[model samples]
Every structure is written in C-alpha cells, then in structure tokens.
Target: MNGSVFSSCLEASLQGQAILNDNGEFLFVNRAFCEHVGYTKEELLLLSIESFVIYEANEDLMKKEPIIKRGMQQKQVEKLILHGNGYLQTTLFTVTDVSDLNQGYYHVQLDKIVTTFDDVDFSMLESKLRDRDEVRLPKKILDGIKDTIITIRLDGQFLYANEAAEKLFNRSMEELLSNDFWTYLKQNNDEELLSKFYQLLAGEEYTQFEVYKKDQDEWFDVRAYRSDDQVTLYFINISNRKKMEKELKESEMNYRSLVEKSPETISVHNGKEIIYINPAGKKLFGIRSFSEGALNLSEIVVAQDQARMRENYRMLLTGKKEMTNSVYTLKRLDGKKFDAEATTTLITFKGKPAFRTILKDLSERKKVDDLIRKSDKLSVVAQLAAGVAHEIRNPLTTVKGFLQLFQKEQEVKPFYLSLVMEELERVEAIIYEYLTLAKPNVESVFSKIDIQVLLEQILTLTKAQSNMNNVTLEFEYEQVPAIYGLEKQLKQVFINLLRNAIEALTDKGTIHVRILKHPDNQVCIQVEDNGCGIPSERIDRLGEPFYSTKEKGTGLGLMVCYKIIEHHNGVLNIYSEAGKGTTLEVILPASN
Candidate 1:
C-alpha cells in the first residue's frame, strides 16, 4: 500500500488514529487523533506516543520498547490522553502492528472517549460511524480502568459496573448487578452517600467529595454526575495525598497547642495592628480578643511611648532589625499603665511578615524593688538603735550632772553652763543622723553632693556596727567634684554598701572605702573588703532580690543599693573571687 493512501484511509476513520514506529515515535497521526487530545497535527508529529499516552495499568510506556519491537498488539486497553489544556480524558486504546502497510510502523486507535456523555449527540455519533465495519469494543475497555466506575438508574437501580467497581464493592458482578445501589447503601447505613446519590437525581450537575474506607484502609476522591437519565460515579484513590494532608494538620495542631499554653504573653502584630495574641497575652492586656480593633499599638501603648513602640514594630516588620529588646509603658484595657519588656522578632504569620513580641510585665518586680528599698532603710535604723541609744545616754548624763552643779551653786557659772549646752547639742546631732536614715520616703530633690563628705557621714553611722563586727572601716578620697543627685538616697546607698561589707567579715577584716575622680569627670566610689569572698556564679547575681552570699543575709541591702545607684545614673560593678576579697565599684557622673 502507498503511504499517502494509507494515511488518507486512516484519516477517514471515525475514531482517532495514529501510527508509530517500533521506537514509539509518531510517524503519522490523523486529524481525529489531534482533536481527541486537543493538539494540532503538526504538534502531535513532533511528539512521541509516550508523550500523550498514560496507561491505566501505571506501566511506563518508555520502558516498553522491547515489547513494541516484538510486534505486541494491545487491545481495548484504558488510557488517559493528555489534553492541550492540561487535563486528562479517559479513552479506550488499541494498537496493532501494521508492518504490511508500512514497514516498522504500527497503527493505533483511540475510541469510547468518556467525556460529558450526557451532552453527547448520539445521532451525530451514529452518522459518523455509519461507514465503519466494526462495532464498539466490549466491556474490556472499561474493565481495564483503575478508577471505579458505576452507572445507576434514576430510581437507584444498578445499571452497570466495571471490573474495578467489583473490587471496590467487594462483590461479584452477578451480585452487584442484581441489587439496587440505594438499597445496598441504606443497608450499609451510609446516609451521606445515599443523600449525595439522591441529590444527583434531583438535577444537580455533579457532586464531588472525599470518602474514607476504613476496611480497605484507603481514601477515595469521588465524583458523581448525571449521565442521560442515570448517574455515573467515579472513585479515584487519593489515600497518599490525604495522609500527607492529615500529617500537616496534626503538625499545625501541635504548634497551636504550644502557643496557646505558653505562660509568656506572645502576640503577632502586622505593622498596623495586632493580628494574633495568645491566651497569656489576652490576660496580660486585659482584653478578650485581638480582633477587638482596640489592639492597635497607639491604643495599647502609653501616649508617651507610642512613637517608640511603633518604630520598634516597624523595624521588626520591615526586617530592618532581626530582633529587638526594649521596655515600653503599655496601657491595659482598664486604662492603667504598666511597664513591660517587649522582646520582638520577625516572623512569617499567615504567609506575611509580622512581629512576634513576648511581653514580660515589670510592675510586680518594680513593686518588690521599692519595698526592698524601704525595708533595707528600716533594717538599718533597727541595727543602729543600740548605738544611737548609748551615744545619746552619755550626753544626757553629762547634761544632767551639769544641771545638778548649777542647782548646787547659788550663782550660775558661764563655763559650766556652756559645757551643759555642748552636751545637749551632741545628743541632738546623734538623733539627727538616726532620723535621716530612718526616713521612709525616697527624696527626689537633686543637689550638688560632695561624695567624700557623704561617704564620711555613712562611715560615721556604720562605725559602731563595724566595731561590734570586729571589722575596721576606713575612708580615703581625692578632691572629686560634687555629684548631682538625691542626697538622702545616696546616703542610703553607701550606708547599705558599708553595712554589707561589715557583715561579710567572719573575723577581723578591713573595709577600705575610696573615692576617685576620673579625667572624664566620672566619680568612682570603691568599697573593698578582705572578708570571705563571693563565688563566681553568685557574683553576677549579687544585687538580685533574695540572693545573697551571706547565709543569714536578706540580700535586700545590696538590692536597695543597686536601685538607688541606678537612679543616680551610675553603674555598680562587683569584682570578687572565692577565698579572696570582694570589691564593689560604683561609677557615677559628676556635676558639670
């Protein structure tokens, strides 16, 4: 046969036709073949047989070169033809060796294409096939499919089922074809499935959903559509995809659990507003939901710090800074301002850049700090009680004895009266120093303080305590400039420092207090003790509340000292080592 004549004959056939070489390369393809796969004739010629043919058997067509060379003729096989628009069309495939017509070329036929069969014009199909001598292929085409296909009447009676449907239903063809689909569904107590079937009969174009078969341990993506007066259902196994989705959901749930149960206030803010807040955040902010519109930064942060907070958020969201740690005064829903430390980092939330801030409330910590200061001052006054009483008694007795001398003499002696007045002034000075330390309120008034004279006064007050502890307190200083600060608070700070040094001594030890002025005008007040030294680990935590090196120490004294020095814009540094002595250096800015 001539090649052009054979091609003309193949093109006249109603069914789609293509001819391939032994290598599965398309040698010739008819217009119908191109229409079936929604590709042009020229485009199909450029492609190979394996390019468009997907086997229902999941076999690799490219690896079937040996079989094709052996003159294999596969009949009534099911395949999914690739369409130009990237969708699959189920069709019956047939390939036969046609070496007689053209050496090394094989003829392929595609028929029974399962499209929207409801809209198919049977009259036009018959007219197209009138000239063909052969009839449609048997049920082998449908049976070769992997997906379960079944057809039912509008009354729910089973009309037809493929071989795959038998395995799906776990029944033979005789049993399945003898019963009604709805009756079987009802007996199985599958109300959802039965409802979908009825809904298809009620004129729905199609119904689709996923169904799990526990007995088979499989998941199926099902689609049912009206086909003429009956309905056809297609069930495709999607267990692998479904399992992956299940795992992703579980991972998301685990993440949510961790976030929801966290004790720290965690929240996510998109540059403009807060999008999410954990349970701890809701409680901290005294709000019910983040969706409440009032979660804007301007509303939540105090007016004074709003600009700073907004800038911090902007920096985090825009990736200007990877993370930020800063303190802000935040306002609660109840209209109260509380200080919080916000540690923020950039994160992807709901697929967009956002800020995750963890807020730590400092209100309670501040209160504890204030109470420690007051308590430390009161403790100092209590410890000074014995010393103050003894000092006052000696002066009172001298004044009493002088008054008696005045009473015994008829004329008053000026020298003896002056001695009595001097004793009374001595008593008054002792009382004044005692009352100064015992004052409860922190003085906020800033003044030019002579650091040397302040240290002298503190050493004078702690002198009795140091003597009783068998510790010697010594003070030395350069002619440093005065520091601008609250005098009373500074007195309490040095007093606490001196007392701690005195108490640290187990046996006789010397505490050297020295004030040095740096060229930059920074004052350094050094307190060194030759007592049992602090361990390395505890040195860093010296000023923390309730943390102390001494066994009976409350640690409030050092804590109060640190707080006061910090208020004076100074840094308190502790240098210590075990079995050696400890040195506390307080650096403060001097008056300009």
Candidate 2:
C-alpha cells in the first residue's frame, strides 16, 4: 500500500494504528495513534518504538527485546507508554506477521488494560454460557465484564443490562428496561458532564464522571463510551471508598477539635520519649516547655507502673493491641503522687507508631466517695438505735412492774412467780432478737415452734398501727405441724411483714394472712393485701438494701425479713400488680 494514502485512511479509522520496521522504528502513524500517544504525526515518526515504549525503571533491556519480535505472546503485556505530555498511558499492542517484509502493522488500544485476559479461553467460556438459539456476543461480552455494564439508546432508553447493573440498581432487567436511564439520575449543573453525556451516542467523545443513584444512597464512578447503536456505561461501585474518604476528612477535623478542647489530660508518647502533650496534659503534669527530649515517660509514670507502661508501649509498637485503660498513681513534675485514671490508645503520629494517653484525676472523686461511705455507716447506726429503743421499751416496763408487785407482796404464790418469769423471759427474748439482728453470726438452735402462735404475736404487735390506719387484718389457718426454725428470727420476720402490710393501706383495706399445710410436707404462709401494690418492674429489686419506695424508710426491713427466711431454707415468693394488691407467699419445710 502507498504510505501516505494508508496513513490518511488510518487517520480516519476508529482504532489507533501504527506501522513499524523490523528495527522497531516507526515509519507511518495515524491521527488516532498520535492522539493515543499524545503526539503529532511528524514528531511521532521521528522516534523509535523501543525508545518511546516504557519499561519499568531499571528494567533489563534483554528481557523486553522479544516483545515486538514476530511470534511472542509475551508481547501481550500492559504497555504503559509515555505520552508526549509526560503522562503514562496504558496501551495494548497486537502485531501482524508482516515482519517477513521487515515491517509490521500494530494495532494500539488505549482506554483499558486487557492484557490480563490474553491467556483466558474466551471461546470455551462463551460456548458454555451462550444459548444455542441466540447469537448474543455483545450480551456475553457485556456480562463477562466485572464492572457494572449497561447500554442505553440515544433517547436514554435501556437497550441491554448486565447482572452487575441490575444489582447496583436493585432491580431486574425487566424492571430496568421499563424505565428510561435518566430516571435514575438527577440533573447536575456541570456543563462539561452534560455535554459529554449528550455526545455519548456519537462514539467520538469518551468521558468519565461520578454520579449518585437516585433510588439508592450510593455513588458510582461512571465511564461512558459509544458503540454501534448504543452508549455503554461502565459503573464502579465506589460508594464505600468515597464515603470513607469523606468520613476520614471529617474525622480528622472532629478529632483535632476534640483533642484540643478535651478536659481529660491527653498526651502522646513514642516508646520512652514524649512526642505531643495537649494543653490539659501539660498543665496537669506541670510541663512548662516542649523540648523534644525533655519529657521522659518513665519520669511521669510511678515507679510501680513504669514496668507495665513499658510492656504496653511495646505492644502498641508491634500492633498487638490498640488501646488500654488503667488506674495508676502517677507523679507530677514536682514529684507529688496523685491517683490518675489513664486511657492509652495506639495511634500514628508523624507517620510513626505512638501511644496517646488521656488521664483523669481521681483525687476529688475518691474523697467524695470516702465521705459518702462514712455518712452511710452513721445513718445505719442511728436507725438501729431508734428501732431497739422503740421495740424493747414496753417489754422492759412490763417486767419491771411485775417485779415491783412481787417485792410488795411478802409471800408470793407460784402463779405470781410464773407471771414474773414470763414477763422477764419476754424481755430477755427481745434482747436476744436485737443482738441476732445486729450480728447474724449468732448460733442457731432450731426447735419445733407453733407457727400459729408466731403469726398471732406479730399481728398483736402491729394491731395499734393497723387500727390507727383503719386497716382490717384477717387470718385463716389449721393447727398446722410445727415448723423447725429459730423462734426469735421467725418472729422478727413476721413482725416486719405485718408492719409493711399495715403501711401499704392508704385508707380502709383488708389484709388476709393465711397459713396452710402444703401437700409436700411444706408449710406455706400467704400474706395477701388489698392496698397500694408494688409495680411489676421493681418487684425483683424489692429486697435490695437501701432501695426503698417510702420516704424516711430504710429498705433494710424487707432485706432482713428475706435473710431470716433464707436461713430456714424457705422460699419467699412475691407476686404483685400495680393497680391490684400484692401476695407474698412463704413456703418452708415442716418438721416431723
């Protein structure tokens, strides 16, 4: 062929074309080829292919010499050629066998790197994938591509869609084909993008831009190219990457702001040396200046914690751990010891591994906690004193009066002596009960006791309070079997239950206390009330000490009751509804 005529015709061709001699010197270049190389035809013809073709830096010349030779499939490589404008363009080279004439024509492809697929058997792959009845090479090619590929007509109507495109749009081909492609996008103000999209059907101008899916909250990097009757769009789902970049930039700003203004002492250390300390950290540690080597980590950490801090420092450097929190007695610059809560995290500062520490002073908090504990102990002691005096005073008076009667009478009858002994025993029992309440370590001598007598005594004690509140109390019980338990502790438990029952009634209400012999040789007692009931949620936390719903009430009352019942191996089950009343059931093992 004539060189000028062939070059002119190749200039108008869509594919980039070049002719080279056996020496790899360019003889003829087309306009498309020159544009692909970013050079003029005259300038391109003066250069040799080996000089213009880019090999890796410090690459061996002998290894790259066989690329342009006649029959080397090794020539099928991603040739990143240097453009005239100092840019490296990814181009692929395929040569014909005209090297016999000392010249060959090479087809140069730009815009994509396809050398990776040169070894793949596309014919076998297509045979398995294609239907026997349909000739659909374009569909197979479009489907084979990893990127989301979609084709649209000049009017933006869908022509063909691939699996990736269906996934990105979250729709099937039938759903996507029913709508215009532009319906999934909003109008953007970029004139350059608008112009490229308008010229997409002409196969002349190729463009790439980013747009978001109107239906999905995702950003897609789109590259549009025109083929025979349709415009093909290659979509890369860059939503996560784009979102991460945006979030990283925002996090940088937010982290800088938080670190600068945080109240906690924040400092950075690289192994043994202090790199950066915020204003709060510097003030807390009494650091006056930032000399690069003046702040040593060992000087600030107390001697006991220095070894631990060193171990954690090594872990951060090796990336075995990222963050740690601990309490330490740290030293200030003046050598004063103060308790500090330190949180250290691994971070990269100045592109090097470093540890960031945030410290909070525990001095004031520790002092407040100590004071609150002391106050709580004093309050418990005062409540104990009041309860002892109020509970035992009447019994002491009854015993004193009976002793005076016996002293006034010269000769006392045996019945009179028995009366005095009974009153004296009641006073002694009250003393023993208070002592057991104080120290639960007292020895328990379990005996068979009348469960009915225990209930009657507790009701009689709370009778005055019940009458004062206009609360009626009723009971139902058979002469049940004797219960094996400590009499004083059981009495105290009943007293507490009855007192709480009386208080539950706001106005006039009835409390039904029942004692029954269960079928399994267990004695069961039910204290049912028609008064203000406990809420369902707080039922679990009812026996917790110091957790009370009443004003000026210590939750110790119910807790003590539960402790006594548990000592007897009893189950105290409480059932309550908010508007309705409460039912407290005590089930205990009966004696033989």
List candidate 1 stretches off by more than 4 Å.
1-147, 152-164, 173-180, 212-219, 237-263, 288-294, 303-323, 373-592
Instruction: Name the top lDDT candidate.
Output: 1
lDDT of candidate 2? Answer: 0.71
Q: Global CA lDDT of candidate 1, please?
A: 0.74
Give the per-residue lDDT of model 2 (tens digit) for 467-568.
Answer: 999999998997688988899888878777877877887889889999987654678899999888999789879877556767645466677777787667
Report, for all candidates in order, the number of backbone clashes: 0, 0
Which tens-of-lDDT digit does each residue in 1-592 have in candidate 1? 8968877898898889888887777788888887887878887776665565434343554553232444656645565544654345676767777676446867778866875334557444333322221212114345667999987777766666777988988888778877878887877787778777767767897999888787799999999988567677899999999989999999999999999999889888875688888899899888875573347887787654554555556556556567878788888899988899999898887797777889999988899989997879878666556556666788799898888877888667999888889989877755654454345346567889988888888888888998888888878888888889988788877887787778777778999999997544578899999988888887768766446677645455676677677667666778787778889888887787
The TM-score values for the models, in the order shown, are: 0.43, 0.29
